[model samples]
Target: MTGPVLYGIPNCDTVKRALAWLEDRGIEHRFHDFKKGGVPADRMDYWIAALGWEALLNRQGTTWRKLDDAVKAGVTDAASARAAMTAHVSLIRRPVVEWPSGEITVGFTHDSFKQHTREALM
Candidate 1:
């Protein structure tokens, strides 16, 4: 309730770890499931502005690999990359965190989350 909102698939191991880490630290956060709710385009736009589409887009995932070479090849800039990610939401890297301090991050790390949360509550 007081911490950042965490977005990702429920089954992702990284998402599980991120949630566990927050729990262990007594950080209350809202979890948004991409599978059921889908990623909001405005949120994606914010992420693209903050971290860039390159980082937000998970090119290493099965989703990305399954994309046609042409689609993958077309992601040369933020707009194109966002289009690709929009078409395949699963191509987003797991655990995109929208910190309460108004910062948006693409992936998860316990230390990083802890630091950001602490700063936000300060």
Candidate 2:
């Protein structure tokens, strides 16, 4: 929001790679550690609106996989996903990045980061 904000657990491999990628490029950003602070409610709303809850939700993650079948089946929409993600921060996809230009990306890829950085600098 203020600069670029990267949100995820510090121990996640993807998060670590993303942090390294940003650092390698010297892209100044802020990291929000979900483990300690948890996801911000306001940002959750914004993320849902921007990318849809489907994009933000990580179905493949062990956290989601370990969830009860009932819980998995209950996530029918944004609100439901938000509830799950709120209760389990790990359910949200890794390294959700909020670019300064009001753009948001769920996961990191070198190409996407490159393009986003270019757009941000513009």
Candidate 3:
């Protein structure tokens, strides 16, 4: 389909909401569940490059809070960020949408997703 792949944990509330939004709008998408199918290191690297480490990491989540201090301290660069995300996929944020055209977006808000859905339909 023309839409991008939507990656996140299935049980995450944000992910559930985003999925419902897409389904309601009849937007085509492929899902990648973090807990079932662990995130690929290469894909994490790509997202880090495209969206920056700060954008890709979900600091507001419970997963991040549970990280050991040493691990949290080690996240200083793209490689370090990738390592941290690989170790704790939940800290990589929920609902990372990778557009077919190669854009990587993190997080989900109804307005933001609605705009993306419109663009994908075009």
Best by lDDT: 2
Worst 10 residues of 1 by lDDT: 105-114
Better of 1 and 2 by lDDT: 2
lDDT of each: 0.85, 0.91, 0.84
Question: What ranking of all candidate models by TM-score puts the best one first?
Answer: 2, 3, 1
Clashes of 2: 0
Q: How many backbone collisions does model 1 have?
A: 1
Across 18-100, the per-residue lDDT of candidate 3 in tens digits comes to 88888987888899999899997778878777788888888888988988889888889888888788888888887999876
Off-target runs (Cα >4 Å) in candidate 3 are none
Q: Give per-residue lDDT, candidate 2, residue 93.
A: 93
RMSD over all Cα atoms, model 1: 1.5
Ranking by lDDT: 2, 1, 3
Please, what are the lDDT tens digits per residue for candidate 1 over residues 6-70? 99999999999999888887888899998899888888888888887778889888998888899
lDDT of 2 by residue, 20-92 (tens): 9989989899999999998999999999998899999999989988999999999999999999999999999
Better of 1 and 3 by TM-score: 3
Give, for candidate 2, the lowest lDDT window spanning 10 residues: 1-10
